[model samples]
Target: MASEPQYRALFLGAGPQMQCGVGQFTRLLGEWIEKAEPGSCTTLTLTRSEGSFTEIWGAVGSARSVVCNFPIVAWKRVMFTPLLAMAMARLRRRKTVLIQHEWAGLHWLRRITYIPALLLANTIVMFSPLVRRELAEDSLVGWTAKKCVLAPLPPNIEAPAGMAASDLRRRLVAARQDGRLVIGHFGSIYPAKQPNALLEIGAILKQRGLRPLIVYVGSFIRGTDNVEEEFHARATELGIADDVIVSGFVASDHEVFGLFGAVDGFCYPLDEGLTARRSSVLACVQAGRPLIVTGPALPDEFDHHARFKELIDRGAIVLVPRGSSADAYADGIVAALKRPPVQAAFDFDGWWQDVANAVRAQL
Candidate 1:
């Protein structure tokens, strides 16, 4: 498995069939690198059939360095590919960098599964201090910190220059005009994100005689868990099934942001609370609407981020106490409605350039 190095970096990623924020980030970053210098970066988005060790070995051998992002959609079986690729890279004395978005955010099993890969990586990149704080609890934290670098993730999806009114956006805006609260949740719906918790908040909104329309501008991530089924079942049990809208995998940024424009605000009640790595929340924040999210677990959570620092300061991002009940969350949603829209702008393109540069420096 040998070839003349033709690329500056070879990015190992998942295919489009699995839609997740990390997947988008991986694609965007690779594209950005390729655009900056044509033929310098190549992305290997492996389908199920494409995960053979030979394919990974060839891809890694063709590049000066290998870069892999973790926990992609449907990564259950496919996760082994990148793990094996990085390990193989080490055995061959090749450079391999592991860009870990979050540690404790994932299930314990996933954290344990990634240990070997992390150990093999010549560089360990983290998006936020939250990951660092949590990794500190583990014995490997000391080892990982030695090779770690911090790089902030740009918004995975940014609003277009203009919000062209779409049919759905018009309808949602109409409902808002009629005194209904249009709540939105973006990105793939998974259990750790607690998307169904929004349904609980919506149900509470319903009982109080407030007509709430819960809009999910994303698809469900099908996995071993019954998260998708349970989400639907809960909406049905709470008598809000009809009120729930699931926009399965909207590919257009304009369309997605148009939906964001329609909602009075966005709700992301993540069980892990707000962290720098939540690019989904960052994308929603760019819509200028209030974001009702679980508050940070630590006081200086966003200290590393200047953009979020401004957003939180302007009251654009409302923080609810962690471990709050559904009733409390419902109240937070109502209170967020009264805040003025955020006029501050986020420089997504600049952020991308920064992230790309940081990654290249390590590679």
Candidate 2:
């Protein structure tokens, strides 16, 4: 590989050890950036204990550009605050871009740190318009909002290696029933996923005299609530336990997408509503599967957005309100199943080009 001697970018976030969304995003982005500009990248871990202030300072001092992919949510504030302060103090000497992955700044305590970091960075890359709008309300962040750009999270999933969806589907069902309609939910088992909503959808399908099987494609997160147990208990209560298939964690992107391809439809009931940041949603889009998504809890601006309007016009996604009753979700899912499958396509190269252009403009 040819070395790009004069150009360097430092990425700070979770590495492979974290085994979470932030870790995956950080690693994937760093890999792509290095491929784009060989020998011009440095990574300093943030989620892992190996991350040191000395290492961060050393990289920031020499790199032409730096990207901090940090999660500033309240639960993470304790860990992120000091590290962020250390990085920001030295970032004034280089072109810095902060990838704010979550809407942590919605809280006052977190915003006190977030606002100054936004001001110090040369640019900000936000995941959703709602977060961007919230940050823009601040006079300081708003003044520089022109420098902020929106790059929706890309799907980390890929088609399974040499494995046909039909073959995988047969294997998945060998121990279970073979004739039921498979409805899949991917990502970590969390309340935000609304597993209970899936049971409700199943109950509705049963009422309509159809056999529906619920399939979970991800593992449970430790230290959080016992969502998996809760999901099972809820399923038993709904009398759909026998029909549920939990795959635990399918590690490979190939297997994940193969499972996705095998499923009849995908349902994601996110508490935050449908936004660009949900990689699970991106995964569904990549497979071109029929989708049932939850709408924003409150009246919001996304309805007016061109991208969302285009999706609705194409019948690519059906939206039910956040915290909507199971019946409402079931209705949305039923309607989604009836629609012709629309191949939702993403241009990953174009997306990365936009990211590269943003960084180069700052440089």
| Number of the top-ranking candidate, with lDDT as the measure | 1
- Candidate 2's displacement at residue 104, Å, is 5.9
Candidate 1 local distance difference test against the native = 0.81
Candidate 1 stretches greater than 4 Å from native: 1-7, 14-20, 34-40, 48-59, 71-73, 139-146, 162-167
- Give me candidate 2's TM-score against the actual structure: 0.76
lDDT (Cα) of model 2: 0.65
Tell how far residue 46 is off in model 1, in angstroms: 3.7
Candidates' C-alpha lDDT: 0.81, 0.65
Q: How many backbone clashes does candidate 2 have?
A: 1
Task: Show the colliding residue pairs in model 1.
Answer: none
Model 1 C-alpha lDDT per residue in residues 95-163, reported as the tens digit of each score: 988888877767777778878777888998887887877776677655676788777667887778876
**lDDT for each residue of candidate 2 in 48-96, tens digit (9 for 90 to 100):** 4654667665556656777765552223623553345335545446667
* Model 2 ranges with Cα > 4 A deviation: 1-8, 13-15, 34-40, 45-53, 71-92, 104-122, 133-148, 164-168, 171-177, 296-312, 321-325, 344-346, 356-363
- Supply the TM-score for candidate 1: 0.86
